[model samples]
Target: MKYLVGVLLALIVFNASAQEEGGLKRPDIPGELMVDVGFNVWTSMPGGLERRTWSSKSIGIYYTKRKAFSSKLSFNYGIGLGLEKMSLGDSSTLASAVLDDNGTTSTDDDFVQSVLIVANPESFSKNKLATTYLDIPVEFRFHPLGTEDGEGLFIGAGGIVGLRLNAHTKWKYDNNGETVREKTSGKFNLNSFRYGYQIRAGFRGVHFFYKRYVSDVFKDPFPSGESPVMTTVGINVTGF
Candidate 1:
């Protein structure tokens, strides 16, 4: 969190200085490069699927093009890469149910289709799940003062869609005083696509953003109602 705050402050200061020096003139380029850093949380998480709030983080990088509808309103669209890490709490790890030769199962009793099993904390030093995605985002922005020079108060509402690129679980444990790090990669019944809504508001190039995904994180065997919904809130820094 401290690192995020420092970056926000630096971006704000740099943007303010640039505006002062350039005197409100719009940049030659109409596109902006944005970086997002945030904390991830799960809503309606199933029992035993607890997350370590501060350790679960998200990062995204995007290049967006803006089209002005008016001095105070504009449309923007972008493509980006997003990375997320979810560190489980209470020394828990994600596990997938085994399917028989017929690829069918009769195990719907679990609260979460993707099961989370608790292990002794002292037995493991690290445990986490990570995912990567290719993302596209669209937004309609309202800049109260004007869109030129990217100054003053601006508010935007947008939707984002992401295609899963990779997902995996990692663990580190001690084996007779020898540390062993293991990583397992699999589909894990995770959804191939995810969609979410976001709202952003701020001054100049630094903004606060809140995003929530309404779709379930898993598919098929994983019950939709029992799947986790992801939420992120954080700082966005934009540069031209």
Candidate 2:
């Protein structure tokens, strides 16, 4: 994660330096620096798994090149880094479930082959799963009445493809009158790739966006149509 952040910072610095050196013309080829803050809601979650809406959130940072087709239309594409956290509720946590030798479900075995949401053995003040992704976003945008220095009323439709970078669970609790924090990192059967549709509209530097992923959050061992689907609705801040 640190490496990825460092790389992104380097790219930003390089871009700024190039602009300062007059290597790029801002008005001729516009770009956007955007930040997304959103709430995550899951649909079709398996029984026993629930998420807290307020605590489940996502943040993203992106830089995109805007290629204008005309005064009122453009195509944009970018790369971004996303941080997502899901806070599980109902005193529940995710665990690895096992299957028997015959490839049938069994709770008593030691083979960790699938994911299961189970009650935590002890109460936790914080219990959450977090993931990181490298994302590619592409969109078509329309600016009505035209844009003035990248600020105006506009609407866009886009799609994003994300490649999973990491996944883990974290817990914070009190044990023996002392605070205890535990973190475990694993694949956890999470989908390695996800694609989604995005719709955004707003004026000036603030925008509203809604995103929904058609793919499942988990892979095999989870039956078709039984896994969680992710959706996000939130605000976007752009142009610095």
Candidate 3:
């Protein structure tokens, strides 16, 4: 008898909660999850290096919610995680600054440098750096066709800020007669935080995204004429 009474009470409570949730008209609905795939690279460094692989890629996934301020204007905000793989032509590896503490004031105190990796090019076929980050994305969306019926074309512009999570380098090639691959991980004094402005345009569930980071990639005292900023162009897949 006691068990039967408990079951009845539980059913009553559950039914009431479900009715309140499904019967009410909600003003805001969740936007689709977003995925971005693209190519990435840095600018403002010294010459003689190049990117040779489409394998230098980037990817991100986000969960966002959209709230309407009007029939045509809405805002979306979300959190995401992303990875970037940047490949540099053989012979280059990041290095600490070469400092000369002479009394002469001509030497600039800023700017660490990248030194060459002396391995034979025949044996060293590839080298790339990879980094991961936790990202926060905010955008204001404008839909001219209105969202009353569902999704439509949207133009959004906003900012994305990232906090560094991990960084590493991978190398592959032949050493002797055997194929070999190596990985090394360290901070490399990389910047712990970064933020940039971005813009997107899409119809329904697909969008194109472009972003340029305003901060340096490294935390070192970099001298003038060096711009180690990162930039990417990609497509965002949403609605799933």
**TM-score for model 2?**
0.80
Residue range 189-223, candidate 2, lDDT tens digits = 78899999999899648999898888888875453
Whole-structure CA lDDT of model 2? 0.78
* Per-residue lDDT of 154 in model 1: 94
lDDT of 3 by residue, 90-127 (tens): 76554333334552323333433333232344534777
Model 1 is weakest, by summed lDDT over 10 consecutive residues, at 109-118
The window of 10 residues in a row where model 3 has the poorest summed lDDT is 103-112
Name the candidate, 1 or 3, with the larger lDDT value: 1
Residue 13, candidate 1: Cα error in Å is: 23
The sequence of per-residue lDDT tens digits that candidate 1 reaches over residues 15-128 is 666574537543456577788889888776554566777889998877788788888988879987778888876456766554446856537654324544546445566778
Error of 2 at 213 (Å): 0.8
**Superposing all C-alpha atoms, what RMSD in Å does each candidate have to the true structure?**
6.9, 5.0, 11.3
Which regions in candidate 3 have their CA more than 4 angstroms from the true location? 1-31, 46-48, 95-123, 221-225
> Residue pairs in steric clash, candidate 2?
none
Cα lDDT computed for each candidate against the true fold = 0.76, 0.78, 0.70
Better of 2 and 3 by lDDT: 2
List residue ranges in candidate 1 displaced over 4 A.
Answer: 1-30, 96-122, 220-225
